[model samples]
Target: MITEFGLSELWEPETRRDPHAFYARVRAAGRPVPQVDPAGNRFWVVARHADVLEGLRHPEIGHQLPGLSHGEGEAERIASRQLISLDPPDHTRLRGLVGRAFTARMTARLEPWIAEVADRLVARARELGSFDGVADLADPLPVNVIAQLVGVPEDDRAMFRAWSATIVSASDWDGSATLAFAAYLDDLAALRRRAPADDLLSELVALEAGGDALDRDELVAMIQLLLIAGQETTVDVIVNGIRLLLTHPEQWRNLRDDPSLADAVVEETLRFRGPVEIVPPRFAFRDLDLAGGVIPAHERVALSLWGANRDPEVFADPDVFDVHRSDVRRHIAFGHGIHFCLGASLGRLEARIMFDRVARELGTLRLAADQGDFRLHHGGLPLTL
Candidate 1:
């Protein structure tokens, strides 16, 4: 029983600096560890790879808890409708409608455009001689790609980027950014309705499923999920990949020697230090026995992606950052089951293009200065060409 550990510890500066040790302890306990967050929410944290996988696919666990009230407010209402917050039936319906517009085929067609965006960003960074990896390459690449795909105009992208960063970071405590984003989407939806364009927003605005279409709040919520999840997770993967390569000079050389290894780097980074620490909280619909432990009905459970990815039983030398690992595909950084990331293909395309460009064009990169310790959420990474 890992009684001393609590979910709130993950937010501590020291834990954020190096959380795997904490995860290792949880895994060694061999069952889900009961914990309460700062807000007094009691939940179980499932850490082992098998357990996490089971939790993800368990039919008894879901996002929507029965009898739970999703507060009534503009932001809360929009959040309630977001794809991530719903369960089957509603989740199935909304995902089906949105999926049509964000298909794998659509993502494949954007490869050339994504590569061009990467080339331009890399070229500019090379010309500058020194640049922040996050700002110059990682951040802008996904932001531009998703914005273009969603039909957000060039002029409004900067604002969207700002809003996305604010919302993801949870710095917009007053809900100002959420309201602003909702208002902007309202206007954008109206415009697309009046004159449809060859972009996702237009497709979504006109999308229909069994004589049903996305209502206003649903549209705003869907776009909100896409913009934030699309931009934020990809940014972390790219930046973390670059950081890993630069830190591991030998791997960097290997990638530079063979840019085809860019895909390998993306997979390895996700396994080694994936963006998400855990998937969103899930509720147990009934008392369930998992890995020899029981979760009471109506309790929340957090499936630890970080813990599962580094399970020693699954990945040998799990802590080491090697881009050539064979089992990297097993990592569920984009999550698993029904809530698996929809923008995953786009995220992969963007990261692969950026990593490939860095290897072929940039030649070699080194940190501009000592960056002390790495936190999962970082402002930027300064690097020199």
Candidate 2:
């Protein structure tokens, strides 16, 4: 019977500024809170740690209801094929094809190069004496790493970064940036067909040519997911991790003294403030019971990862940012179940390397001034070294 608040409250400037306060109330309600989105679509928010975990793995819940038409627009058609938007056996098939490129071992192979990239970025920031964390270090490192891994040419990476920023930040698709990105990938695929390279895009292009493995739209969708999901969320993790450490001076000193604590810092940051407040919306295929409430058939269900990560029952003193927390691994910031983030290993590696290098090279750092609350896409995070 949680009826007082809904999605409108969740989207308010005040709530976005301090979401955990809203989430705390939702979790206390002891059930899935029903909500109506701005579009007037009915949905439910699953907030508790146990409930969110179960919702992610539930058999009756998915991206789309069973036996429903995919949709009938260019954007909808393309979006339906994305890794994040599909259910099994399509999800299983696509993840299998792309998973080879992002395996833990493959990610490990890139660590030395990733560390080199992090070192260069940190060294340049140190030389400058004052730098914006987002623009100088957090942004470029992942863009370069993921671009190279995806076979996007170094010369065109600036354009790629701009397109990503545009598309992700837009409230509505409008399809302008997406169309341009698809066209660029189309050209890149043509090039890879003529001259294969040692990268993921070239591999996908080969699969598409083989006839049975992939289609043109699926190929573009895969690359789009890899490029955007690969970099955007990781940027948040890195920048927010830095923001947390500087704000928590004692934690910053802890990492400064022991650079190896970078991995712990990444974990704690994900728990404290994950990049994704809610995972992309899921749907209830039939009337379903979860978290002591029932969601009607075909209704949208939003799983709040931020809420679950801070559940006090799961993480002791969950509000406090602690790099030494024993249960930090339980946080599902990258998600759980079948739709888990394909780039988790790579994201972790990149963040760990960047934090370690910042600790070793930057020495001591402080925020230049008050920059208000940290945002996913922000102007900058000015820091004085």
**Per-candidate count of clashing residue pairs (backbone under 3 Å):** 0, 0
The lDDT for every candidate, in the order shown, is 0.88, 0.87
Candidate 1 weakest lDDT stretch, 10 residues: 370-379
lDDT tens per residue, model 1, 16-83:
68889888888987767777777888888888899999999999999888788888888888889999
lDDT of 2 by residue, 206-275 (tens): 7765664667788878887877888899999999999899999999999999999999999999899899
TM-score of every candidate: 0.96, 0.95
Name the runs in model 1 displaced over 4 angstroms: 1-8, 208-210
Error of 1 at 95 (Å): 0.5
Task: Give the clashing pairs for model 1.
Answer: none
Error of 1 at 306 (Å): 0.5
